[model samples]
Target chain A: MAEDVWILGIRMTKFGKHPDRDLVELAAEASMGALADGGVTMKQMQILAWGSIMSGGMGQQLQKQIGQTGIPVYNVANACATGATALRTVIMAIKAGEADFGLAVGVEKVAGAGLLAGGSRGVDGTTWTPRGPVGAVAPLDGRIGTETMPGVFAQIGLEYGHRYGGTSFELFAKISEKNHAHSTLNPLAAYRKRFTLDQIMNDVMIAYPNTRPMCSANADGAAAAVLVSDTRLRTLSLEQQHRAVKVSASVLTSDPWEEACQVLPDVNTLTRNAATQAYEAAGIGPADLDLVELHDCFATAELVHYDNLKLCESGGAVDFFNSGATWRDGRIPVNVSGGLQSKGHPISATGIANVWEICHHLRGEAGDRQIEGARVGLAHVIGLGSACGVHILEKAAA
Target chain B: MAAARIPLVDYLRLADEPYLVASECEECAARYFNHRVACANCGATAFKEAQVPADGVVRAFTIVSFAAPGIEVPFVSAVVDCHGTSVRANLVNVAPDPEHVRTGMAVRLTTFPIGTDSTGTEAIGFGFEPAAD
Candidate 1:
């Protein structure tokens, strides 16, 4: 039988622009924090995996930073889901019985990175390269598609508003305010200040319907998780066992090219598909969840996922918010860690960062922002390919 | 001198009067906008060449105020369902406002120059315009 996995330790650096720190130092800080949290030493980690985007050859360099133990290291990149991908990799290693104690680290330095600062700079910056689609019916079919995440998501907000017929823009503002307010309680959050709905709505518009506050910042940070298999947990010390949080379900799904046909592609068909699978794998539904940490790359994205994850009816998101269903003290409190909206989305680090937040909830250690009796928590992230990874964790069976 | 023209995408070639080219799958009657190695729908490799009608309905659109450094701002980005396939591009020849660009609006495919090379060669790309009656 495949053995169950437990998050023995999870930690992340305070998310913000760490211009003084490079990727290796960021990763080392996170990994060491995780190691200390799990009560494990570098020598004990059987395998190490990293989730990074565009770090060229930082995988081996990071290993050296943590003391080259000659352990097998895997570098993974799946857009924004990179960190969760790393976590999933370690889960697979433990499931395959190839590893006992594993470490999964996700890191990204988006602050000064050319793209992170915004705009497509590089050798290709000024070059007008027209790469036409395969069979554009007309010369101009689908030509203005920009890779700016905000642009695409803003389009989704507009379409969703048109389809549903409501003040989605207002709802978006409320969502931003809620998340920013939550950030005030989260010390690890990148932007810890609260925002009024007017402030969020009036902020400079990056894309129509999406203001600066509505979109997560280009952030820099790293998060790491220590995973120990059930078999190994039996031998671990009492402290390790006490810190262990059970993984009830973990699922990752990529875009089904057909999703392109959807009017709001960013409404995320993949998240729906993955969430259903994750709920099934966890043997629980959205109703049973005590807390959730979804992508929230954009406020509208979060509103869309509320329906995609079956947390509420399709158009009931605004109502869900009004009813206080997703408030930090509501029926199913969400983003109490402030989410990517406030916590900072360091691309690759977001995956494990979500995990770290959920672990805090599951372990009953999330001091001020903690949800009462948050026994079940969900962590979700959607990559640019529209890839989605949903993971469910619960307090280990006593 | 008449500037040389180029297609932004590999599949595109001409800058003038350029219409969309597409591929049809033999296995499942699935049609693609351009030639694809395999059928996205039914997964059959057998394909036939076809061209999509230049018209589609505006499924969704946005006004992009920020983009890559070189890309212009405040353009109307849109997803037009051309020939059963979703094509994402900017809606041109229209104001970047809700009153001007609307969902379910009729749009026609058109191409415009993205930029010109210093060597007098212009790179052209495609977009959608409000369909004329």
Candidate 2:
């Protein structure tokens, strides 16, 4: 018999600073919340998959708080893909019959703890040129100019402008303006303060067209999920099954490592490939998406992704934003929960946050940030180097 | 006269007009800005050295405001399309303002000193400046 997987419970801490708190506290808080929501206890957790950038051995550390369980635990980390990758492991293990119940939890404290606590590798580890703009400091292999993350994306924005005429700087500002405004409605967001287009444009420049307001703020938070096999789910009551959202599709992919340069917003090849498979698996297309919670770590990224995800034609983003099609009441609302820009990005927690937000929308539980009658949702996250994780979610069939 | 110095890359020359070192895939005829161990286009390992023109059109550019330690902020970094190969370099001799630096502008490669070592060997690196008429 083919195994079907379902998300039984989802929980996320308010994404903000908790400097005095450590990873164990953050992880357990979300983990316990998920268990409570799903009507499960630590005794039922058969497998564990933990996610983070640094502060390793999360599954073990978290076990101490929840009671030491002699179960198989996996520590998974793939940059920004940490959350999705961790959640996917849980699904895979449950599908393979290794376990009937699994937990996926992720936590980080980058915003409050500083950069070293965040995941910045110092010097000598670049796979690209003597220098690439992915680092904020000069790496061991390259000069200082090629280090900041903003620099890499800035280069991409520039190329987009050159290739198909231009990627309007105003367009990227509007993305920031919209996302910040959306965040005002989400109390869980780290930054709920809104900014106008003029304010966003006038903010300090991080890299070229990307202003300080255009980048995602580092944050501290945790998000978790509880997954169970359909066999186990069938044993639950009708009310439990009503809240279970189906994990329709999940895909993880990496770069081809070919000898060539990458364009920032033009980084569509890998994502485009992921989209084709995920949509096919979900039995849906871009037009079918009721809501999306994706990696908008940067405002510019949101613009490029709308095209990469094939939601619109290439070079159509300039008009896409102006049409308000992505607004909360628009046809396909994006980041209605404020996204990374307003919600705060804790790296490891981001993917799980997206999953959490989408699940809430699917269940009609999202309060102020709800997308009206959303039926299907997509959660996407990308890690530089890079790894891409995309998942599609829908209501489970009765 | 200043002492002669070598470029950061073996193929990059700093003695005269600045230039770039490139490689071409024998199988696919695709070119690259720096040397390649294998052809990313066709997966062929055999590659021969290729020369790139000093001047090319700017495909994209950014003025880096917050940068690594010791780097001057508000410096213009550019991705230049040198013939068919793409080169990542900083833009020099031009104002770092959007009004001045823009995509599709003409640029030419130039070499600059990157400080000397204990052995008195200066490190030479390459950048692009607005092209001459």
Candidate 3:
């Protein structure tokens, strides 16, 4: 039988531009902060799994700044799912009995990176150039159709509206408004000011039905967590054990082959697959979840995910939002930490930061936005190369 | 000088009549754009060249107002469903706005110059335009 894993400590750097801080510095802050929070030292860590999108050999470089621990280290990069992937690496080690104490840190420096490109940069940046031993070729982006993040997600939202009635530009804007409103309570969020419905609706349009405000804020940040096996937790201090959050389920999935998926990533099917497996592993359903922090890379994405995560009935995401169930005070409050939109999506850091939010609510340390009695919560993140990760966490039993 | 023209992609045929071709799966007959080694739907290695109809209905679309460094903004990007196969392309010969473009709008394939090389060779790209029934 596999041993259980518990998050002993978790820490996240404020999500915003840190022009003075380098990637290693941000990573070190998160790593040391997590160690202190867990009441453990770096020397006690048996393994390290570091995730970053913009850098490599981060685990080794991170060790130099923190400590020269000779433990096995894994460097992970999976687009936006990098952080969750790194955390999962540590959990697997603990479950496999490889290590009792493990540390996972995710960091990225993408502030001012501008729009995320879907394909490679072509020579002219306008037409498709076939790859081969031939002349200078351009990218497939502008020629065929834009594979840009904003365009892809905007199409996804419009498709949902076409498939199911009741979704409109105003509805999508309303979703962004809610997230902006939620940001006011999250001190770590990049943009704390709330926007009215008109502000979100009238914001600079990046893509139709998705304005600039609806898009995820690209920022620099890092988040880290320390995990300990259940047995190790028992030997820890009484306070540490009391504050631990149980990792009931950890799952990661990729896009299954579908005709449509080959063209435009089917963010829906993979997310559903992960969610189903996570719920089955956790022995809980969406109904039982008290809070959720999902990847709202775009406002349009959040609506579709509400259905993909099974938080609502099939073709019922708009209705679910209309019911006010996703608000902080509602039945199943979501993105109480302002989500990726306001909390700022630092790519690799976002995955673990989402888990950090759930852990906060479960530990009752979420301050003003706390979801009272958040015994069970779920955190989700999906990247465009088509990776989806779902983790279910629970408050330690009294 | 009349600029020499060339299709932007190999899948587009510029001979005689301009139209798009796809690789059809032998097992499931699912059509896909460009070259494919196997079927995404059935996983069959065998494929046959199939010509896709020029006409399709806009299943989904977006008017992009922001883009990367060099690409122009406020263009109509759309997913057009020809029969059952979906094609990703842009809507052309029409204004990039909600009033001019919409889902379920009838359109057909058309080609336009993406750029011209120093040799005066024009690179042509495909897009969908409002179809005349």
Best-performing candidate as measured by lDDT: 3
Q: What tens-digit string does per-residue lDDT give for candidate 2 at A339-394?
A: 88789998998988899999998898988778877889999888876888899999
The residue ranges of model 3 lying beyond 4 angstroms of the native Cα positions read: A124-139, B1-4, B36-42
Q: Estimate each model's TM-score.
A: 0.89, 0.91, 0.95
The reply for model 2, stretches above 4 Å from the true place, is: A112-145, A257-259, A262-266, B9-11, B23-43
Please give the CA lDDT of all the candidate structures: 0.79, 0.78, 0.88
Cα error, residue A111 of model 3, in Å, equals: 1.4
- How would you encode candidate 3's per-residue C-alpha lDDT over B1-133 as one tens digit per residue? 6667777767777766688877888898887765566776778899988888889998888888887766677788888888777888888999998888878889999987777767667877789999997
**What interface RMSD does each of the candidate structures achieve?**
5.2, 6.8, 3.8
CAPRI-style docking class of model 2 based on DockQ: acceptable
lDDT of 2 by residue, B1-133 (tens): 6764646555565545666666667887776644567776778988776778888888877777876554556778777777766777778889988899989999998887765554565667667889999
lDDT of 2: 0.78
Q: 1 or 2: which has the higher DockQ?
A: 1
Candidate 3 structure quality by residue, lDDT tens digits, A109-209: 88888886754564644333455422224556665678778788988888888898788899999888889899999999998989999988888998887
Error of 3 at A291 (Å): 0.7
Q: Write the per-residue lDDT of candidate 1 for residues A1-398, one digit (tens) a residue.
A: 68889999889999989989999899999999999999997899988998889684476787788868888898988988888889999999999999999999999888644334334333343444543344222233124465567777777766666667664568788888888999999998888999888898888877777888888867899999999999999898887787799988888898775634433455467888999999988899999999999888888777777878889887766678778888898898878888877888899999999989999988889998888887899999988766788899998755
